[model samples]
Target: MFDFVRKHTRLLQFVLVLLIFPSFVFFGIQGYSRFTGGEATAVAKVDGHDITRAEWDAAQRDQVERLRRQMPGLDPKFLDTPEMRLQVLDGLVRERTMLAAADKLHLVTTDDRLQRIFATDPQFAQLRNADGSVSKEFLAAQGMSSVQFAQRLRQELSMRQVLQGITATAVGPAGSSGTALDALLQQREIQLQRFEPKDYLAKVSPSDADIEAYYKNPVHAAEFEAPEQADIEYLVLDLEALKKDIKVPEEDLKKYYTENEARYSTPAERRASHILVKAEKSLPEAERAKAREKAEKLLAEVKKAPGSFAELARKNSDDPGSKERGGDLDFFGRGAMVKPFEDAAFGLKPGEISGVVESDFGFHIIQVTAARGGDKKSYEEVRAGIEDEIRKQLAQRKFSEVAVEFTNTVYEQSDSLKPAADKFKLELRTASAVKRAPQPGATGPLASTKFLDALFGNEAVRNKRNTEAVETGPNQMVSGRIVKHEPARQRALAEVKAQVRDRVAAEQAAALARKVGEARLAELSKAPETALPGATLTISRAQTRDLPREVVDATLRANADKLPAVEGVDLGAQGYAVVRLLKVLPRDPATGDMARLQQQYAQAWADAESQAYFASLKTRLGARTTEAAAAAASSPAAN
Candidate 1:
């Protein structure tokens, strides 16, 4: 029943499945469905806490917005489906489950730590000036307050930390390293003797009666159904017709270049070095105070001897990433460092030492090594870029105007391509010898459901007229007038005689092979030793890769279970195979190979452990999720 549901569920499409869940209906009646003008629905209940419909909807909107931003031209209707809604709900449920488990374990982020993380974030820092101050205009433009954005960052970071801790605790150590993976990688050389089906082909031939009998079989008849089709003429309006109409005046181009000159300029940059003292909110106050004093001492030394800043940094800096290189950060433009750190670094002259600066990472003693000014690029260097932008903008505007006119002219003229072509002075193009199925030239636009429906629609074909203009791309539209239509008919039997004969012969050969195999099996059952003329059944431990390369994949899957003592099994297109399992290898843990396996399977083992841990946690917390939620989370429309 589940398999059948999976097959037919796809036919409902992404949008319908997301929006039409049974849970939604249930919540609607109870006045708990937020999306349908009621109180928030409870998608899941984790440890007595409700995962509300409002939260699920917000998550879904966030996922959709992210995808829309990444893929600018994607259809918005794709997200409004039932399937997508269900997928979003399912994901929210899982997240809620994880959060519940984290809470039980007392895993959480403090307010101070969250504040430090936000202050250090590069994206947030971009909203500040060179003097370490936030710009109100930039904050407004991004549609977020400092406090609101900080809270969001904290939630995301806390969830990440909790998930990492869970996974780490679940995956302990690699226990199957020595025997399992090592023995699998080792090669075993062997000789092969193949029983080719083509070798037996010359000995088998079917009579006329055999062919007729095979064709009469219900299974064989079912395989020979005719292809379904539709025939009609369609009118198309294409934007390519407006390409020649677009023009970029010299005055406009010059004006645009002059007005946006700063957009093409670059910013000044600086090089600096620093000594860092690592500190975290989780550390004791006493320990943190000690770390701060150490940073102050380093700052004092650097201030007294500015030229020796690099030497002091190399000796005292706790940041391993930059300490080895004398804490040199290399050249950076504006907004490259944390607010407090960047402000101190940029304010200093070359070879000048700064007072202790505090950031999320810890305290920093900065030294300005050098500075470089910005330069304007040559006009010739940026001319090609400017021209390309102008071309696209002008082309879109011109195409939109001309397309509307073309659509109007086609509708007002006689019901044929000739009249529309003459009225608009268009060179009429024809699709010669086109078919119903997808083909080159007309296939792309014609393959759409709406376009195909319009083609076979009464007004566009029987009455003959232009179609309403259809938008295919940004500022691009198309309209077409039908010129001709052809009806479909079946070909005579004589024309398809060769195809029928080949099909009949293929069926006969397969049946004959099966019969021979059955007869051999009957004899083997009576006397197992007499199954083969001289060959004896060999038993040995083997892996999937050790099997004959030329063996049919279907034969392996079908006969694998009937092993250790099987005889004369038909292998379909590969004749037959006999099998046996001699011995089983137990896993070994202590060896050099175990070290390699531990390194290689570390990620896979971690994922397996994580899944097991999640399942165990769900059971412990008595977590229950609706079918609708699971479906919503897995749907393609959710993202």
Candidate 2:
């Protein structure tokens, strides 16, 4: 199919031009309206070229949508911060500058490459046709036409070319990476002594006055403040619930089965083996001919002695991926391989060999091995699945009509969800005390932020009415009202007196432990050959399997030029550890490996060079956000 398209390029181009003219006119009108509307406000400038507010909004939305898809249940409030908005705007500016650089470099992408990219992209894989052409339905679903998609693809490829050109020569300097690696891999020997909390508990006892003083302190009072919370009662209307009642008529099922038979059937697939004669696409004509001649000879041999195919492939096949496996490609469906290779293999019957076939990868001598699993399933075999699909469709159609009725029922009778629940036959569920975030043990539509926001808003909380029906998830609407609300206040000290006493005693005990440990270390430092009490272990600088962070850092930073250099680390409630640096040991010669660090070092340099190039490009482009736009980005109310 791709071969046919390429062969008729001239005729196809003429037809495309005729088909695209009206679309261009339609888009021209849209472009004019975009510039005339309120959306045309300029938010930034790149080399005196305006960046409209509409463009910024669209880019920001794209970033948000990408993040949402990558991370489900992500709190939208986290993305609404002023910092996030500015980061999004900066990203847009960077992209624009990159494209401008690409234009300056005159980088271009061919139509053939664009078609291949779109055909292979995973997002459109489901929409691909057997002929390798994407359908109109797919384009419409993506909200783009072929022309628009091609233009975007061209810009993306051009930007990639420019960036690759800029960073291609990024190489780390000599000896620098090795020195960094050596330092990172350095190991030092040290000795440690840990003082347990229980050992000092008996020595440190605080009175009631000490506990009272600690609890009354201003710093401790901040810890006890509570957050505002609410409880809501909600009614849900999920479209999936309607599927149980939807009955697809047998006649309608039969009609659908006939109209969309392909959806229920699998295309024929073939299993094949091939001996590839590898030759570079850009090889000299003589070299290519030599490879093709060799492949043709192999084809003749395979045709004469089919049983020797696997043995010959093992010894002569140039395809490393399958050479050892007798050049087997296993079973592959249509549109999986290059056209020429596929055409040659599929044309042969099982146990038949084909003449040498030429592809971009070079010549291939092929043999069809086996074929299986392309049979159309009987109607009875697929009845259950077809019934489910039909029911889902019916449920969706019913939802479209019922959603309106559900919204009206809730709005008109805002005082209670009883009416809406009864009309929709939904359950009126009550949720216990819930905060802005989802409440513990709470699941279903009521757990969503939108549901909580609507339920807790003044209209629902103050007026004590049902919220407007909110779409919490796909085909699911929830209308909720606050059943109870709690305003945040500082927790009373009397209610927490016991907890405060325990906390105060713990602090005093830790301080006592630290004091005792410090005194012991001081004494140990004075002695020529002193052994500290408590369990001691010799450890390496890079060894921190179970060592506390405070103890590890003190050991690493301690002066070990002299013997028995001591360091005291306060370990809070767990007490303190007195670590003694027993000896200064140089890094082990066997510790560092230069070979392992080269790729990482090279990648770091490449990243740095790319950043520097982009920084310079950004400066040269003279991209600047307007004061008003900057302010808007930093404001919570910014669109």
Candidate 3:
């Protein structure tokens, strides 16, 4: 993998750039012990402390959100798989393991440090409210509470501190850069003999007897074992179809509108203008004082000549966003601006200038031009929307109750899905053939892994009975009984004789090709400058414009310490190539080249060390998880 990455360095770097930050930029730790209470099940245990299902679900949601935001055009379903879920679970388990060790070591994050991290990280920075407090509404939208967010942040920070020290040791020792630079910057040129498998195919032909002998080998039989599959007849209870019978009362709509009135009301807005003198939050006290003094002078000038405010703002204001429009910030509601700035603007009468105010961005001199909005929507205007929302809500609630009943009926009856189908008024559907996993273009409940697992399980397949109902979609449940079951068994040699013959021939040809290629390579390596009897192309360290990736990988990784060094690789269907290293070209390092190379090497070593550390940590904690835990985490519970 490293050799392939080195061969496609540019592409590798591009991929790495896209993937580097998402692993570390965590968000939404989900539920707190306070929020979940005793409702959450333990998904995994690290050093005896449990990492809850709620936490794992939260982490998976956070990761999915990150992927969606970063790659907007990507199909979200591609990210929804057992593999991706397992990756998220593993990450959560690793983090919990680290936190457990950190607790034993008495490592903790201070309030000040936690606040600083929140202020710095872009993910949490936007959640800061005007009053310099974290916004609960924003946190709630992210599926996190204040306590959960702080705990997650502290856990990450504590682990980061521990990892930082460990990874630092893996970086290069002092004065080692020069030697590394020489090897890294060295280039190589090679003479190559092209040997296509077609050339050997004509030279080596296997007889029918030889093919049969190879086909009958016990080692080859296991590879031909067929995967278990089943044909199932299933009943699907789709909520949307059931929803057609749901009804919403006028009184319910009115009650919903009255309770969620804030959703239909617009907050009051103020059109304000401000002249800002910018200073960094971390600026020295003296520097901050200077900016504030400048702001006061600007405020005094604005007070003296209010008519010239536009000219003064355009010339002196540090706010590039509004300075050109004469400090115009348009109209904004409460919570839009920093608390001090918002307070100063709202407190003033129209056409009145306020005293200098300080905010995180620095000091601001403000004036309110107009106040508008704050309209409460009438029932007549929102009646239709409220009715629709209430109807949908009621339908969803009814569906949940019915779904549970449907699942129970199917499980209890076990003989057939007819009872559940009759109870839910759903039609029994039959799938002709289904694989262990969903095939491309498969749709509906049949495509779901949970449903497939039940369909193929012992009771459903062997006993010819209905399996437990499986939730396949939002407000969707399904249960299936195998119509026909195919047990996993090795295919008969007669049935796959032609396929086996072709494979045996290919294997024999490749072996012969490799044997001949290795002998030629050995002979070529004895001479430093001898040419082989084939096409010779000049190759360079910077690029391999037309070479096959496998060839380039072999060339780059081949030792060039001794000229005419030989490397032979089997290129599958294309046969084998014997590469002869003819020259080793060393170039002088350009300005900062050595430093950059050293940094790259250091990063590689750090990553290796971190991976090793985490592996050891996982082993030490005796961490373990199950598919049952993942299923429990993903399944929705009654609110």
Candidate 4:
């Protein structure tokens, strides 16, 4: 074969092209694109730049992480929805559009402005130093250098500047704000006759024939079918298992302890009291001088009558937080206060008063009440913790090596997961009836979608072979095989008859209620003075009066220019609602605060203008979002 191919290299090459080119033309490009971060994955475009799938996925993960942090008790699955993911993409598009606009508008944040914002913004308090400087140490802790932090801050400033003009200056048209607020708060006296399905359920008796026919309906098959599932035996190669195998040398642990000795010691703290006078560095020199003189007088009083320091601080201190506590800054560790204040507090011994000291916040007179801590735990006392830490570090480093060996063993052995599990000392875990998607409350490797997907892959299912080691999470790899596969099957009608009967009954009941409600509505239309049979209450968007939201909306939306207007609302499965609007009343004054409403209206007006301006910017900059990248993005901003 080699001799023949060598002698006819050109001919062989031609034959190969003839055999492969068609496949390449049909499948190669598409198969390749799916893996690349180019056109195939672009969710949006801004200035002809593609926002790829990788970026969108990363943004969504970050968004989920942030939301998880903000609301720790909320289910992560709720936040990781298709709608929220698409919305995140929408946000990315809007962000990209703003960046493009800012670039075109030559909007660059000035260094001075950046410094001022970092120094004065309460949001950046954690990143601000004692002298109103950027905290390099804090930035380093966040893995951002000062230069990178400055760049990130500048980008944020620029993005803000793009929309700042419209949002900052927009004003609602005269009476527009009041008109909107009044409409929202407008109350209507309503007589609600709700035909709830539950109330009418007794009226519905679905025949067996009807139930059987409904169950047999093709549209309802999915709800009746048991999803395809499998029994799987999965082996996980993870840091936890590796840690059990790790043997840490005591000398190495001692070395780690010495290097991180600060971790073993309790940080020193000082209890102090101070009287501060408002004297920001940005204040005029004379004003600052006056503040210093005032602080000096307070210091003099403290020195003359040490016991009266707290009394003077309570009366004379401008620091609202501490002043209410008699200027007592309860025990705080180093780096908790400004450099000058900390120095003054720490320099004084117990019951000693310090001279006036200046800081970015103001001039302060300090009185140190007490000092404590600075205790160190011996090596033996913290030995176990240090050894565990060392083991984890070593295991982390060893994970990649073990994962590769584990991968090879799983694939080479192919038929079973036992070899890999035994080799890695991993538990041979078995899960029955595991579906492709993680079940609710699923945990560990079974909860990982990647592992489930690989387990259910065609090759793994058909051949009963182990899946390729899939990375389920950080330092976690899993390979699973199908022990038994169950294809999706329809349940017998007898099996789900009770549920089917109830569903059919509810649906029929709902339909009947709507029909009767509509008939009642027609009679009310003909006879405006017809008395309603159900509850009579005043309702508005602001106060629903315990009525169904549909009834409230129907009542509010009824043509109020003509009194005694009648409307019918179909409430789907809940049933129907008929609202008779007796009269349109003035917006209730007590239901909502007019001042707050006005402020909210003004804010909304500004937001709408900002969004409108952003849309215009998108048009000019050739920024566009793919339909798939947006779900509820078109919802009215103010509403």
Candidate closest to the true structure, highest lDDT: 4
**Deviation in Å, model 3, residue 68 alpha carbon:** 13
Please count the clashing residue pairs in each candidate, in the order shown: 20, 0, 0, 0
Winner by TM-score between candidate 3 and candidate 1 = 3
Q: Candidate 1 lDDT, tens digit per residue, 387-413?
A: 667776666666656777767766676
List, residue by residue over 142-248, the lDDT tens digit for candidate 3.
Answer: 45567656666666677677677778777675466555554445556777776665556666677888877776788877767777777778887765667566677
CA error at residue 24 for candidate 2, angstroms: 18
TM-score of each: 0.51, 0.60, 0.55, 0.59
Clashes counted in candidate 3 amount to: 0
> For this target, which candidate reaches the highest TM-score against the unseen true structure?
2
Worst 10 residues of 4 by lDDT: 20-29
Residue-by-residue lDDT tens digits, candidate 4, 1-639: 233333444543422222211111212211222222465556677777777665666666665654554455565656777777767766776766766677667788788997888777766664467888766654443344566556656666777888898899988765898778766898888887888888889998999999999999999999899999998888878888898978888888889889999999999899998898989999999999989988888788888888888899999999999998989989999999988888878777888888888999888888888999889999999999998888888898898888889989999999988878887899998889999889999998888876777888889988999999998777888898998999899999989999999999999999999998889888898997888977668777888877777777778777778777889999999889888888788898776677877888889999988878888888887777666455423321111
Q: Which stretches of candidate 1 lie over 4 Å from their true place?
A: 1-65, 73-89, 103-106, 115-143, 170-175, 182-184, 196-223, 231-239, 244-395, 404-468, 480-504, 507-596, 616-639
Error of 4 at 607 (Å): 1.1
Error of 2 at 548 (Å): 3.1
Worst 10 residues of 3 by lDDT: 28-37
User: Can you tell me which runs of candidate 3 are displaced by over 4 Å?
Assistant: 1-123, 138-159, 165-186, 203-205, 239-414, 417-428, 522-550, 557-566, 570-574, 586-597, 608-639
